[model samples]
Target: MLTLTENAAIAVKAVVAGTPDVQAAGIRIRGAEAPTAGFELTLAPQPEPADAVVEADGARVFLDSTAQAALDDQVLDAQMNEDGSVRFALAAQA
Candidate 1:
């Protein structure tokens, strides 16, 4: 299963907090044609029926089928950009 780093959890929680109406909001990751090619991230009110839910440190992340498999042994991390935006990155789990 995929794991989220402390910073990633914090960042995800912060992002979800912005949506006052959606208490269960989470970041959803979806893979394109190739999982290694790239991933698309979006804020969702909740996880889909078939999504793999990963929760840590009060933060939730929903991964589609492809994303779930692709990130199975990965660690999710977050970085703050100069413009005050969060950038998500994936790294091999040690």
Candidate 2:
């Protein structure tokens, strides 16, 4: 189950709606790779903005076919920070 915060969803929708150079972007709640088991992740970076978003709404979303299992219990959220960087973190999916 994927659960997105209301604020996060709003922020994501607004950003993805107007940005053009942003090939794609999305919050990534990914699991640790090789030799690791617990989950931890960073926001997927976008082609357009690097400093503004913690995660980019990029090809990651489309690649779900390949990575869905890894992202199974994740959530996507958007946050407004005074620092101006979009924040992302792992959460218990409902």
Candidate 3:
């Protein structure tokens, strides 16, 4: 299963709060066509059918089966760059 770090959850929540009509919104993750390609992440108004729902730190995340499989045992983390931009990273569980 995929998991979000505290900072990632906080960031996701903040993003959802800023969007209109996003009370039901959550972070959605999908796998790319190529195995080596990076995953896609966005705020979705709702979960799609058969999506794997994961919750942490009062935030929700929805992932399709393929994404769930690809992110298995992975951790989602967020970091702030020196230029005041936020970057997300995926890493193996410790």
Candidate 4:
């Protein structure tokens, strides 16, 4: 299963907290059609029927089946950008 780093979970929670309409929103990972293709991430108000949900540190993440397979051993991390913005990155589990 995909996992989020502590900072990533904190960042996700902060984003959801700022969006009143998305109080119960979780990070959604939209999988690509092909194995070699890239995926996308967004804040979703709810999980899809086929989503694989992972929750930790008071934050939840919803992943499509393809994303679950692709990111089975991956980790989500957050880093500070040059402009002091937060950037999310996916890394292979070591």
Candidate 5:
């Protein structure tokens, strides 16, 4: 199973709510691929920058059976340079 940071969850909820297109499209979670291990963090509308937002919730992200990988038991964070974008690297459940 996957979990979301409190702040990250809030942030994502807000973003999804605001994103008219995505909101209407319906955001979801899944694995990036068939991880040899377990999970492999994945999502639709591909989050830009792949991990770089504010608030711990900024790290909050979505995942599916496909996206969940053995992410070191936690969501690894990433960010972009030009803009402070946010995304999560979900590890599979061990």
Candidate 6:
């Protein structure tokens, strides 16, 4: 399973909180195939039926099948940018 670092959880919660009228919202990850294979992230109101839900420090993240498999042994991290944007990164679990 994928794990979220403290910073990542805080960043995810901040993002979900900033979205208006959204209940149980979280960051959703799915496999993407644009040019090169990768993953896409978005805010989702709820997890999909087949999605894998990962929560840490009250932050939620929904991952699709492909993403779940790809990130199974990974850790999610986040960093705040100068312009108040959040940047997410993935790394192998230590």
Per-residue lDDT, model 5, residue 16, is 61
The segments of candidate 5 whose C-alpha lies over 4 angstroms from its true place after superposition are: 21-27, 36-63, 68-84, 91-94
Candidate 6, residues 54-86, lDDT tens digits: the string is 999989999999899889999999998878899
lDDT of 3 by residue, 7-81 (tens): 888777776776666667888888888888878888898889998998887788899888999989999888866
If both were scored by lDDT, which would come out higher, candidate 3 or candidate 6? Answer: 6
TM-score, structure 6 vs. true: 0.90
- TM-score of each candidate structure, all chains considered together: 0.91, 0.46, 0.86, 0.84, 0.38, 0.90
Tell me the tens digit of each residue's lDDT in model 2 across 6-92: 766655555454455444654344344652575544345452232223333322332232234544576666577877556655466
lDDT of each: 0.91, 0.47, 0.83, 0.85, 0.43, 0.91
Q: Candidate 1: TM-score?
A: 0.91
In candidate 4, what are the lDDT values of residues 16-91, reduced to their tens digit?
7766555568889998897677988888887899999888798888999989999999999987666757788999
Q: What digit string (tens of lDDT, one per residue) describes model 5 on residues 1-94? A: 3454554564455556555465422234444444555443333444444433222433334444344343325643333234545554444434
Q: Model 5 misses residue 44 by how many Å? A: 5.5
lDDT of 2: 0.47
Kindly report which residue stretches of model 3 are placed more than 4 angstroms away from their true locations once superposed: 81-84
What are the per-model numbers of colliding residue pairs?
A: 0, 9, 0, 0, 31, 0
C-alpha root-mean-square deviation, candidate 6: 1.9
Q: Kindly report which residue stretches of model 1 are placed more than 4 angstroms away from their true locations once superposed.
A: none
List the candidate numbers ranked by TM-score, top first.
Answer: 1, 6, 3, 4, 2, 5
Clashing residue pairs in candidate 2 (N, C-alpha, C atoms within 3 angstroms): 8-78, 24-57, 24-58, 25-56, 25-57, 25-58, 26-56, 26-57, 44-56
Model 4: CA > 4 A from native: 21-23, 81-84
